[model samples]
Target: MLRIGVLVSGGGTNLQAIIDAISNGKITNAEIVTVVGSRPGIYALERAKLNNIPSIVISRKAFNSLEEHDTAVCEHMKYCDVDLIVMAGYLSIVGDKLINEFNNKIINIHPSLIPSFCGPGFYGLKVHEAALERGVKITGATVHIVNEVCDGGPILLQKAVEVKPGDTPEVLQKRVMEEAEWEILPKAIDLIANGKI
Candidate 1:
């Protein structure tokens, strides 16, 4: 089985989707072995606990530097024997140590279609807000390999969601999550876990 370590910062809707997908057999040959929260008291950690998965909290603020924080994360993943690292709404910008250690084993689910409203400073609701502001008719999600660059990795999967009239950023964000992020993230995981990628 492919051992996965999920990294999260806030509400873990994407993480929940992965758990559900695995539970329902939509994703075979993989299991979530560990969950690491960037901060304590996040709902993602609670989800991991409820699911009986091992979890840890490693806050960047507590570390002396970004490299130190990423080193701690990498060590924890190595300890867990994780084959893959999934960034599910993880807000922290990982440094080179973790990226180099994990290499192509890391994947991230971006809320937007990427290359449009993604990159540094584009995350969470801000992405949706930017999309709406740009008045794009189509907005979606992208699952891609995590590299040294932010959201600049090779794309694995993308699903487009239509931008409807009278849609606010919040509404579009929910739609994109439901229609795109939730669907493609698990599919990407399955693809990677099965060695189809």
Candidate 2:
């Protein structure tokens, strides 16, 4: 089985999607071995608890340095014996230790189609706000390998969502999550787990 370790920061709606997919057998040959939150008491941790999955918080603020935090995160994943690491809305910027340890084994679901409204300073509702500000009718989500460069990894999957008229950032964010992120993230995980990618 492909053992997965999920990393999250906020509400974990993407984490929920992965959980649902696994439970429904949409993602075969894979199991969520653990869930790591960037901070304590996030809703993502609650979701992990509800699913009875092993979880822990490794808040960067608690560590003296970024390297220390990254090492802690890496150590936990290694302890879990995770075959894959999924960044499902994890907001923290990972350091070289974790990136080098996991390498291409790490994957992330970005809020945008990427190469646009992505990279540094683009996340959460910020991506949608930028899309609206630019008046882009086509905005979407991307599932990509996690690399040292933020969101610069090879794209595994992308699904476009229409940006409707008078759409607020929150509305577009919800639509993108429902139509693209929810669909492609799980599909990408299945592909990786099955060695199809």
Candidate 3:
């Protein structure tokens, strides 16, 4: 079985989806070995606990530099013997140390269909707000490899959700997560674990 490690921040709704998918046998040939949160007291940690998965909190504020924080996180992953890394709403930017070590073994879930509202400065509700401001009728999610260049990694999967006429940023964010992000993130992990990607 592929030993997986999840990096998360905030509510970890995607992490919850992944745990549910694995339990339901939708995500095969892998098991979550650990859940690492950038900060403590986040719902992602709680989700990991509820599922009986091992978890740790590596405080971003504790380190004086981003590189230090990423090195510590990568150390934990190595100790856990994780074969794959998944970023399921992990907001912190990992440094080159982790990127070079994991290479194409890491994957991230972005809130929008790539090349649209993705890359530096586009995240959370801001991405949805941009799509709304631009009046894009279709907005969705993308799963991509975690290269050193932020969201510039090659795409693995994408599913579009139509933006309704009266949609607000919050509403669109919810719809996209439900219709796209939650579905594809786990599928992408399964694909990697099963050698489909």
- Per-residue lDDT over 1-197 for candidate 1, one digit per residue giving the tens place of the 0 to 100 score: 99999999998999999999999989999999999999999999999988999899999999999888989999999999999999999999888988998889999999888788989999999999999999999999999999988899999999999999999999999999999999999999999889999
Residue-wise C-alpha lDDT for candidate 3, range 68-155, written one tens digit per residue: 9989999999999999999999999988999899888899999898999988989899999999999999999999998989799999
Compose the digit string of candidate 2's lDDT tens values, residues 1-197.
Answer: 99999999999999999999999999989999999999888999999999999899889999999999999999999999999999999999888998899989999999888888989999999999999999999999999998989899999999999999999999999999999999999999999999998
Off by over 4 Å in 2: none
lDDT of 2 at 52: 98
The reply for model 1, stretches above 4 Å from the true place, is none
User: lDDT for every model?
Assistant: 0.94, 0.94, 0.93
Question: Candidate 1: TM-score?
Answer: 0.99
Q: By TM-score, how accurate is candidate 3?
A: 0.98
